[model samples]
Target chain A: ATTRIFGQARFTCLILFYVLFYGTYLVSGALVFSALEAPIENQIRLDLIRAKQDFLVRHPDVLDDDLESLLDEVVRASNHGVSASRNVTGGPNWSFGQSLFFSSTVVTTIGYGHVTPLSQPGKLFCMIYALLGIPLTLVLLSALVERLLLPATALLRSLNAALGHLYRPFTIRLVHLTIIVTTFLVFFLVVPAGIFAYLEPEWDFLDSFYYCFISLTTVGLGDYIPGDSPGQPYRPFYKIATIFYLITGLTFLMLTLTVFYDIPQLNLSSVFSSIKLDED
Target chain B: ATTRIFGQARFTCLILFYVLFYGTYLVSGALVFSALEAPIENQIRLDLIRAKQDFLVRHPDVLDDDLESLLDEVVRASNHGVSASRNVTGGPNWSFGQSLFFSSTVVTTIGYGHVTPLSQPGKLFCMIYALLGIPLTLVLLSALVERLLLPATALLRSLNAALGHLYRPFTIRLVHLTIIVTTFLVFFLVVPAGIFAYLEPEWDFLDSFYYCFISLTTVGLGDYIPGDSPGQPYRPFYKIATIFYLITGLTFLMLTLTVFYDIPQLNLSSVFSSIKLDED
Candidate 1:
């Protein structure tokens, strides 16, 4: 009974500490992001406003309201991933290649959302598709990660045998985690970022790296899609290759996570679960 | 030896079947989404082009290249969440409230991408923030869900006791799951969607529900966001409320999954694990 009471107290403390930690992280993130992006956003807004003013000055006969409405239409179309620029020669957003990319993003929950379903029926279909596809993707990823763990475990065992007297188990596990994380970063992030940077005309190394990070993390802010630049060659093949890269990268991420969880000292949740708190 | 061989064979078949199933699903989804959305997308694209042409016709003195450049600028600004419309009175997209929303979305991996960080530093900070925040969020949600499961388990125990004589354990568990799922749907999806539909002038029930579904799934295609309507009153309050809704709804989702995985027969991963293939 005493242990249970103590466990409950510790649990509450742990929860409180985490909540505080999370809250601080969020507030700091909000402040940092706001500080970082607000100036740039304001600058862009001002530039656009000034451009609109300049256009009106140049074309005096163009009614303000008409231009506003035209701009609105253009903005709305752009929001739907339909470019108004005449130079844009890519097929429509819902073409087979883009649709396939959209479908893959949906199932994997990366959801870059550059091209979402606009029609009502399309939205209904998307919801239904995601309902089924998300779980299927999860199961498939888990199964693949399970398979990948065999080699990872083999590496760990070999390391353990070789260094049994030299280091602590925790140190050895940390080393194992570092090696796997480095491999994951190299193959899934750095190499992929380099490839994306080379392929995308507008994206530099940083932008490409950000895309890989955002995508593999499943944040997928959709600000920079791979093949959406105006007139890419072999768009379908590029999209398919990205789809494979995403799936493979996600599997490696899961593999890393599984390996991380295997080290008992590193698994914080297990520590929490070991505490025997009363149900009530 | 016979069992080992059979297990290996079954595992291979299982992997193959899953791969085939996922491939078919992706292909069908691509087809369906393409069929449903292509016409609408093309129509929108044509409409935008026609609007541009009409504008050019009205303002004969306006150079086509100049107008195109302006439109491009407008589209680029709009993609960054800045409206070119003079009537847009809302503060910049990176206000504390919206940044809070963005921070939450990033940590949760929802990543609406409606307003992403444009600066290089912001992007770097975003990645680092997400790296730390995602794990913190996962831990926090797991802790909260662990707490929530107490009542959920109690409910299951009572249901078992009530129906023990009349029904099998599986049936009782199914009933419990059904009740929980209904409650989740009602409280999180249904009620919140209704509120959103009522609050946002443009969103109907379907749009609101889609937003809820997409967000809760962390797909966050971000075609729709709450509190983004022009000149909305109390925007910050509304955004904070949405943050709370998302976090709570996510916790409930995790709770449902915990209850779901508790049922022995329903746990397919456990069955697979039990097959016990050789490590090699």
Candidate 2:
């Protein structure tokens, strides 16, 4: 009875902490985005309009017979191919903040851009390649979590054994989880975040931590992508580093999840019969 | 005890069915792609060499510009630019499949494949756009499932009520989920797939279902995007209808998830809270 009471209290506290964490980042990011919307919009709009005008002027007689003759010659030289652009399902012009938002959606796999993907090659690769990679990454992260959880689960079991007479299993597990999370933060979040800050040309320590937090959360807002930095040499190295950081960060996240998974009482996705699933 | 056995069987079946559905599509796509690879590569190589020789003869002085200037011009026309392609990631000479893959990545929001939104606008829009749409689709689907689940959940409850009083609440929920899923397939998959075949220009039933399945799963391999058929008119209607289909399909997915969510189960993500924090 005493242990059960303790377990309930621990669960409430953790839920409170998670709610607080999620609330802080989402609300703050929204506010920041709203604040900067105006300037970013202006910059993007100006560039886009200039490009559109230039395209139009350069191809002013685009519909004429002279263009037809040019098209025929180009087609003849290329052995008779047809044009494939401009039956596009276009929307209103997007702003800079909007573009960042779009990039985030794509990276996060939450693409809801009513706008269609134009161009044939662009459409085809988008399908199965992601299906292959996303699951691979998820499984790898889950595997790492399982590895990390070995020690934590052992510690949890020992704690349960030590306090068997006094405390409930639930209460013991909560303490174990808190300890594991702290360890993860120090090693995974704090340390690697520092290293990323060192490497990212544009981000300071604060910004790098922020980026790590956001990306690992699966938010994936693209305002701070690695390779886009101007004058950055070794673009591939920087890009590859970012990918490694993402995979690593995801592992720590799975570690947190494994702590949760340790409790048979809470697993929800356990569809396998040999495995007991808990309700998260 | 008998009820529990039945429930376990049901759960196993559901997981197996879902896995098989997804696995078959992916594995077959990969096999098809692998088989096509050699033939496609040869054809593409022949075309590429032909294009190169023809370009050399036609524009003999096209390479007269300095290398830096040429690179700069192409960079100016990257996909990140609003005027540039939205789905593609890289510069000129990218394969058709690469751009199609890019489109799938962007639209599905996997944003993997090591490439990313190049232009400022593309990035911003990617995030913001999903924010508005994904949740809306989720809400719609959850509502749909709620209607389907009520009777199903009640049926399980009544079945248990009639059976021995020895079974756990979890077993009842499992039976209910199975019924609901069957209903989902009949309505979401079979009926609508038949309708798509009838309405879409020149598409057979199998092709339509394949399209529906691919689009809903967000695999979007671009092998069969609608409205791309030559001589097709009223493209806007087709595009809009396709968009509606995506939104509606996504809603069903969310509805199924909500059922899972309501099961009060321990999903791995929430397993950490299995331990109550207070006693430790």
Candidate 3:
């Protein structure tokens, strides 16, 4: 009875700790994104207003009683990534290169929807592509992660041997996990974000990082696509490279998750099961 | 040597079969979506052009040679779901109900970026919310699936008993799996799609199904969102109900996957490991 009670207590405490940790993480993200995006959003708004003013100055006769409303409509649409005038020309979104990239994103379950298929056929194809591609991607990712796990395990074993006398196995494993996570953050998040911030004229570091976080987690909101800038050189090549980056980054993410799950104490699934045992 | 050869042959056949199946599925979807969306896209284009022509007629002075260019730009922006005029007004997207719905989407990894966080604070909160919410959602879904599996297994056992003498165990299990899959499709996909199609003015059955499938799979492309139309009756209530629907649908999805994974013969992970064994 006492043991059961103790187990229940621990489980409750762990749940509480998890909630607290998650809350802190979210609040911190909000703070960081707010700081980064606020100034940018304001700048964009100002630029948009200036553009409107310029258009008005050029054509004063266009300014009627409805001019304010029309201008407001234009600005609102721009904020939502739309424009009022239809003259802005880019090639078809479903060009071969773009289509292939879109297909890759769909299969990976990223589904950015920034450049969606307008035709029914395209939408249908997307669904069909996703059904098969998702599982295939899963299998491929798992296989790669499985391969990576061998080396990761070897590293853990070495750490265990080196610290077996000085520390508990759990402590050593946690350290190993931290090292792997930091490596992921540096290579996938930090370095790539820096490159993206540099390459994309409009994006700041936080935007890039947010994009990375969103994509890596497979949330893929599609608000901040990398290479859609007008007159971007070698756009297809850039897109393909981005695809490769996503594939590799996803593999590393899975590898990190594999390592995290290996530490049974940190496993939420196991924790929940144990809590269930206490109830039973 | 013979067994290894057989395993390799099987693996090769499975890969080919998977590709063929996936390709066919994608092609069919393309065909369907093409047929459905072509007319819609055309109608939308026509309406946009009309809107622009009307605006020009109202302000004849605005019709310079540049008017054509300006109109085109406006149309192009609208096609991409952007707008130039900011006069159109609606309630804030992050209402208490909408925020709750958004939070649900984020944690589930559906991430329909259609209605994203514009404010810095909102974006930061979103990231932090996702960081913790995802794992918690996973834990909750897994626990629910685990419980469901008991009854599911019992159902499988009964099927085994009834079919053991006439059919192989593998055949029986496949039949059992088919039944469960059908149930999931009926309850989660078909029925809900019917309801959503009825509620959303623009959505047809296929669109609703696509939405459900996309959301459940966590692809969340965000082309079609529920309850976003202006002045929809009981908007908050509808949004909350949609949130519930997603949670339940996701739980059922996890259950279906659990059942699928329980079948050892269909296990891709194990198959890969066995192939590795042959290589070793």
Candidate 4:
């Protein structure tokens, strides 16, 4: 009986370890795969769709080294111009500065979903890079979170003690949550949204906010990407400002959550873990 | 006094509302702008950097697409082989099916960021399309989150209350988070990662995970894309599978987090709001 129990325990431990590492990859990888094939785009289709869009929309006529080359793509029968755009950064001419920027984004986990790699070799390398990087990001955030814990816990406890008389545990938590969410919105979301609207070309209020929402979730769908906006003379400065904001914002978010979690009396993650979920 | 207070409140309310809508874009746009202009990717610089990568990597020569049109770009000062890489659908004319798929990725926010909009108009439209689509995505996620909440919350509460004696609130919450995260990974990441590795020709486990991480973050870096892995026969099935995974995975991630938050007893958005984090 003792041997059997030990064997079972060992098996469980092995499964748990496998799940811990491979499990993360599985979920994360699925997200990537699903995102990749989810909607099925053909390069040719993209060209035609853009062809129609070109006729309908009056886009800013910008002149640049990149645009100049892209124009030639349209002139050719190749779909690279509008639809079947080729991945240009790989080959014997991959850009490190670009890669640096790419690396920063990946480590930050603020992936913009733009300028994807085309080659199989490139894809393989990127995968290896991320495995190391994602954990690095987590470690960075954890350290930040640890620093934020004491004050946050004290604040939560004080708030709870003060408000406990007036409200239930659930309602008080809600109140505390409201405060956290609001703070994030005002500083991280609203102020930045305004800055972007003012700085980025042609962005109105709605567009700016949409950009922020997409970004913070780390979704990074790059439709309204900045610096692409014309008339912005301080382009690099604007870009750097964004980088600072993302790093700080994410840190703050993590910090804020850590503060909340520090309250031993007020924690809730386990509150949801026990029941069986109907994932099917 | 009331008027002044109300006016300020109204302004704050407006800003808050604006942020709820556009905050993501603001964060992503700034980073993208920064990355794009960081003295990165000048053709000369890139070639020098990638020379080793180019020589070291040995890719199977893909025989599917022709190299005829790229010669024209090569003839021009545009040294990058704009015409020769990764148009799996093939040819300049393009079919309606392919075009629709391309449009869908852009508009849907499943944006592989592989084949991007080349023309300024196309890029601009891409932005506008994402703006509209982003909210739609949020709404979809919100709805899904709401739907998934009932079971998730029940699971958390039961698990926590039962395991309450053994763990702290933090551990409980972590357990719940783990459960939901696991469910999300199994259905979205693991299975999809496996499928992507299978479909993406040369993608190994690490590469698959990287793609998932990169794509889901919305970096759309395009460094490593799917369906472009040379010589895949069933392009359409692969495309559809990729698209489905993105939609479901994204929705599930939101659900996991949202369900975590939906526990009225554990809410924390109120914390920052109470602090009047923007009082200054």
Candidate 5:
């Protein structure tokens, strides 16, 4: 009874700690993002204003209101992923290949939103598709992770056999986790990022790495989708490759997280939930 | 040994079935979206072209190429969520409130890319922020769900007692899940969507519902973010309200899923994994 009471107290403390930690993290992020991006945003806004003024100066016959209306149309169209500019290239956004990629992104919850469903039916269907697809994807990923854990378990067993006399179990498990993390970073993040950087015309190593990180985490801010550049060759194939890469990368990420959570001392979430479940 | 073999075969069959189902789902979605959206997309493309031609015809003294270049700049600026037009309203996208909304979305993994980081430092910081914040958000939600599940469990126990002589345990549990699901829809989906539709000037009921659904799923297609339309009153407060709504909605969603998976026979994913875990 005493231990249960102590456990409840600890749980309460942990929850309070987390709430404070999360608030601080979110506030600090907002402050940093506001500070770092606000200046650049202002600069971009000015540059745009200057560009419009230059256009007006260059074309003295064009009335300001006329140009403003045209710009309004252009902005409206662009917001829906339609480019009014002649310089813009690449096939339609709703082509089969692109739609396939879109479908994959939607079900996976990556949802780049570079091209969304404009039609009412499309939006309705999207909600329905996600309704079934999200759970299906979760089950598929979980089953795959279950299979993958076997080999990981075998690796741990081999490590235990070889290093039982040398190190403690927790230390050995830490080493095991380190190896998994290293392999995951190399294959999923670093190598794929290098390839993306090489293929994308504008992306540097950092941008590519950021894209990989954003994508695998499923944050998918959609600022830097691959294969969307103008006049790109084999756009469909490139998109398909990216879709495959995303799935594989996400699978490996789940595997790594599962392995990480297997270590009881390291799984902070389990620390919170385990006590409650035991109390039940 | 024979049962193990049978279990392996069943597992393989389940995997194959899911793979096929997922593939079919993706392909059909692609086809439907392509058919539904292609005509509208083509119409938009033509409209844009005709608009440009109309502008050129009206401003006969203006060079076509020069106007095209200006449009290119306009498109580029618009892609980064900046408006070159004087008619565009609302505050800058990177205001403190907007940044806080962005931060909340990122950690929750909703990641509405309506406003994203433009600077290299901003993008780098975003990646780092999401790295730590995602897990933190997960733990917080898990802890809250653990607390919420107590009342849910009590409800289930009451249902089981009342229906003990009348219905099977599964039926009682099913009733319990139905009540939970209806409550979730009313509070998180239907009511909140009504509120969003009432508040956002341009959004109809479907758009509002779609937005709520997309956001709660964390798919966050970014097509219809609220409080972003021009000249809105109390925009920051509205945005903060939306952030709170998303967090609460997501918590209830997790709670529903937990209650759903609690019923052993209803959980399809567990069927695939429980046998394997038992073999181990």
Candidate 6:
């Protein structure tokens, strides 16, 4: 009974820790993004206002407050990504190349939603595409991760052997996990972000890193899409490449997760299940 | 060797069927949503154009080609959801209630990207928030699904006992699955959709259903959002409620998937794994 009570206390502590850790993470993220984006948003607002003022000055006869308000409305619409000019010069979003790219994003559940289907047929196709694609993508990614796990497990076993005399098994496993996670971060997040930052004229490193994190986690807020910039060379090729990058990145993420879960001590599912068992 | 070949053929067939089935589902959804949204989008577009033209006509002095083009640009911006008036009147999007709602959406991977973090601090907080919130949400959802599965399995077993003499176990299981899936659809999808349709002025039943499906699947394209309408009563409360609805809806979805995966015949993971083993 004492041990059981102790176990319950530990479980509660774990829960609390989990909540606290995540809360801090979120609040910190909010603070950082607020700091970064507020200035840019303000700058954009100022530029929009200045642009409107400039246009009004050029057409002094129509410089009414109402016109200024209308101009503001128009600029706001453009910011929301509803520019008619986008439809005109931006080309068809659902073209074959773009559609394939879109399909991949939908199935993977990335769902950038930057260039969504406009027409009834396109939207219908998109839904159908996702229905099939998501499962298939899952199956494929899981298979790939399963195969990758062999090497990962082998590495863990080797680490176990290497450190058996010097460290606890959990410690060795933790070290192994750190290595795998670092590799994932370096190869997937850090490198790709650098490449993207270089390629996307508007994006700095932070934006690219943010994009990488958002997409890999499948949050896909669509705030920063690649290859949408005007005069982008080989746009289709770039999109296709990005699609491959996303697929590979997702697979690696799954692999990392698989490794993380393998370390049962760190696995929340196991901990939570044990707590449930204790409750029963 | 023959058995292995046969297994491979069967596996391929299963994959094909899965693809076809999901494709049909998505296509039908796309068709329905397309029919629903196209007219509305067109109407909005026409209205925007007409509004611009009227504004220009009222101010005959601003009737130059340049002014008309500027007006077009403004109208287009408005369409993209970037109206300055929205920022001015919509208040800060990162308010406590909205931030909580946004946090929930991010963790759940239903990143609508409608009201994204604008400041750097906000963006950083968003990333950190997602890093931890996502896994925590997953664990929570999975635990809920696991608990739900016991009753679900019990129900299936009872069905098996009731139908064992009359039908094959597979058939009984299929029936059980159909019932569970239907219940999930009715309870999570249909009912909430009805409520949403009632609440959201612009969304018809189909739109609401589409929103539910997109959200439950975690696609979250953000084409439609709730509680954004002007003069929404108890807006914060409504947003919080929607957040809960999404969480619960996702939990049910996981339950449905758990049930689906329990059926070994329909389990792609097992089939694919076996295929890998056979190849090895």
Global Cα RMSD, each model: 2.2, 13.9, 6.1, 14.8, 2.4, 5.6
TM-score of model 4 vs. true structure: 0.46
**What Cα-based lDDT does every candidate model obtain?**
0.90, 0.46, 0.71, 0.51, 0.89, 0.72
Minimum summed lDDT over a 10-residue window in model 1 chain A is located at A271-280
Q: lDDT by residue for model 3 over A21-78, one digit each (tens)? A: 5445434444444454445444544554455566667778775446566444544434
Q: What docking grade applies to model 6? A: acceptable
> What digit string (tens of lDDT, one per residue) describes model 3 on residues B143-225?
66765676798899999889899999889989988998999999999999999999998798888888998888889888788
lDDT of 1 by residue, B164-234 (tens): 99999899999999999999999999999999999998999999999999999999999999998888999
lDDT, residue A274, candidate 4? 18
Where model 4 places Cα greater than 4 Å from the true spot, the runs are A1-100, A116-125, A255-272, A277-280, B1-236, B243-280
Candidate 4 Cα deviation (angstroms), residue B218 = 8.0
Off by over 4 Å in 2: A1-147, A153-251, A258-280, B1-56, B60-78, B81-148, B155-183, B189-251, B254-280
Winning model by lDDT: 1
Question: Can you give the TM-score per candidate against the true fold?
Answer: 0.95, 0.44, 0.78, 0.46, 0.95, 0.79
Question: For model 4, what is the alpha-carbon lDDT of residue A79?
Answer: 22
What would you estimate as the lDDT of candidate 6? 0.72
Estimate, for each residue in B43-96, the C-alpha lDDT of model 5 and write its tens digit: 988988888899988888888888888888889989898887676688899998
lDDT of 6 by residue, A1-280 (tens): 7775576566566655755665565555445544555455455556555656777788777756767666554554344344444234444344445555556678888887765655545555666667777887788777667666767888988998889899998899889989999999999999999999999987989889999999999999988888877677888889878987898899899998888887777887776777757765
| lDDT of candidate 1 at residue A223, scale 0 to 100 | 94
Candidate with more favorable, higher DockQ: 1 or 2: 1
Q: Model 2, A1-280: lDDT tens per residue?
A: 5764464455445444533543343334333333334344335536644554453355453333432333233322222111111121121112222223332233334333322222233234434444454444444455455445556767877898898778887888877878877876787768877877777765776666655654565544333544444455665455445555665666776677767766777553232212111212
Q: Which tens-of-lDDT digit does each residue in A1-280 have in candidate 5?
A: 6876676667777778877888788889999999999998899889888888998898887889999998988999999999887767878999999999999989999999999999999999999999988888888888877777768988999999999899999999999999999999999999999999999999999999999998888888898899988888989889989988998888889999999989988998886777665654
Ranking according to DockQ, highest score first: 1, 5, 6, 3, 4, 2
Which window of 10 residues has the lowest lDDT sum in candidate 1 chain B? B271-280
DockQ of each: 0.80, 0.07, 0.27, 0.07, 0.77, 0.31
